[model samples]
Target: MTVVIETRDLGKTYRETVALADVTLSLEKDTIYGLLGRNGAGKSTLMSIITAQNFASTGEVRVFGEDPYENAAVLGRMCFVRESQKYPDDFKPGQAFAAARMFFPNWDQDLADDLVKAFLLPMNRRIKKLSRGQLSAVGVIIGLAARAEITFFDEPYLGLDAVARQIFYDRLLEDYAEHPRTIVLSSHLIDEVANLLEHVIVLDQGRVLIDASADDLRGRAVTVVGDASAVSGFTSGREVLHTESLGRVTSATVLGTIDAAERDRLTAAGLDIAPVSLQQLVVRLTQKEEVR
Candidate 1:
């Protein structure tokens, strides 16, 4: 696959604090990528810089083999959907969608109209009169209907209900299958969106921690549970991520996958093996580890 987005030693600083640090990543064309991290972890900052909404203090960014900053040709191919997308206070939802149709070359009015009805968004109401969930729906609708070559959604489902969110996800996947464009989704709902992601990029503080395919990440860690003594014995020379003890029972998460030999040993010791949730695995990786 061709590379659509690339960054080298990307860094951003605000006053004396670092927003993003020494990050290098490449995004392949026509793939769904999940950019995940806790709030204030530089996910938004990176998205802003990549979309040319903000400047990078250091390093380089290239979209479609060209610099995005001040480059309308490259910028025209990208659509950024953010939680706080602003519109004129007097503008109605219908007006917003109409404006988006004009700006995005491949805009699909039928799709936009369908999403408006599906989300139950009030078209005639002023933008400021809509509830948070309704406002979020407007962003989601535009993001999907614009059909830009590269779309970046930065927590676009912030206040949407479960049903609305599911609709957004379903529409995104369906349109992606038909259009086949590069889509980068920055979200905090890790487990909910895990299945939609082909690749996962996790950030801790301001640095990139994990960047790998979902398949590789699924097998990157495993948990073992059994009697305290047996579990402790099994985990002794391994890289442990998390551990929990209750009475005489214990469960632990380790950094490596369980191979045939390891599995046989655990089975012989009457221990149980389970796959770790991507959310739990990431939480452990980015959080302060507890002492046993």
Candidate 2:
């Protein structure tokens, strides 16, 4: 239950636009966290600030119980891998891995070499000449091999094919099991990594919309479908997230757990209750908070 990263009233702004606002979050140690949000929802900005690659306009952040800015002692234990990670124009995958091996204290050369082969990276070719997927592969290889205590990957699977994406997921899980660490993965491919996440933090329009464990989020919302009258009656006085109606049929999504008594009542009302998918819940939660 030790906290690895924590922020208080964190805010980041650019001229007239605010990228992050009054964000307070606590990330526990040795757990996989999914930092999910739509594009422009401040996921990357938050990651950059936490990694000390960018400065926050206001508020404070602590990594490993100390300030991270220019603190090599703390920064050395963290790695931030993103699609925008640039290498010298002439540097190749092999060169990048060699450099990472020197920077990260826990770098695993064997893992790096195996990943290079699995990714089929052209070690001889310049990084600038690689395709998008190839470039993404380079980032993934470095991320896994770095073995930092805290690693943040911001959409590092940009152009990977389904097969390559699966490989990344497989390797990440395999490695994490053997050497547990705090990992924050920010990706738009929600359903793909939904099961991999132990906890999820969702941002919407510069605000933290949802932060909860995967298990708790699973039952945080439920959808019921049936006759319009029955569905309406069942969801009344409850926190309805989303609702749709077609003729006399209606389906409504409500936020809150339905315990035994509520479940029995719903069953008696002839309403069929279905569990909500994580993707569906996030889509509803960050979807402008539609009025039912």
Candidate 3:
């Protein structure tokens, strides 16, 4: 796969605090990536630097094999839509769409028009006066309508109802099917978008915790439940993310897959093996970072 964005030894600092530290990752072309991490894990700061909205303290970033800062050719092909995006107080939804139309060469007015209706966005309401849902709709509409090559949506569904969020997802998938572009979605609503991700990148404490294919990530961890002593013995010397015991029964989430022999051992020990979801694995991974 072609690498659309590459960062090498990236680091960002603000005074005495490190926001991003020695991070290196690549985003492949024409793929959907779920950027997952807890708050203050440097997800936002990483996005800011990738979009060239902020400078990194160390290392470098290349978008399309060139710097993104003040590079119009690269900047015009990418759009970063934030959850708390601000516009001119007097501007309306139509004005926002018009500005995006002028900015993105691939902007589709027809699609923008259709999305405005689908989102039920008021054309004349001042952006400052719109409700939170409406504001989110504005961002979603722009992010979708712009049709940029690399689009970054930073929690773009905030304040949107379930139905509206679904609309955004549906529209995104439909459009992406027609025009495959690289998309990075940073969201806390993991399960909701789990199926849409082709790849997953997890950040913890300003570091890259995990970066791999979503399918591989799903099989990286498994939960074993059985007698406490047996389960503990089975998981001994392995990476355990979480463990719980209810009387004689014990359930443990362990990092690493079970092979043929291990599976036989688990079965002989009467332990039940359960698959772990992407969301559950991420929670355990980040939560496990708390005490370290």
Q: How far off is residue 90 in model 2, in Å? A: 0.4
Give TM-scores for every candidate, taking all chains together and pairing residue i with residue i.
0.97, 0.96, 0.96
lDDT of 1 by residue, 85-198 (tens): 999999999899889888899999999989989999998899999999999999999999999999999997978999999999998999998999989999889888999999
Worst 10 residues of 3 by lDDT: 283-292
lDDT of 3 at 287: 91
lDDT of 2 at 225: 90
Q: Judged by TM-score relative to the true structure, which candidate is superior, 1 or 2?
A: 1
**Model 3, 139: alpha-carbon shift in Å?**
0.3
Evaluation by lDDT, superior candidate among 2 and 3? 3
User: Any idea what lDDT model 3 has?
Assistant: 0.94
Highest lDDT scorer: 3
- lDDT per residue for candidate 2 within 1-292, as digits (tens), equals 9999999999999999999999999999999999998989999999999999999999999999999999999999999999788999989888898899999999999998898888888889999999999999999998999999999999888778999999999999999999999999998899999999999999988889898999999989999998999898887898888899999889999998888998898789888899999999999988745332
Clashing pairs in 2: none
CA lDDT, candidate 2, residue 23: 99
- Where model 3 places Cα greater than 4 Å from the true spot, the runs are 260-268
- TM-score for predicted model 2 compared with the true structure: 0.96
- Candidate 2 backbone clash number: 0
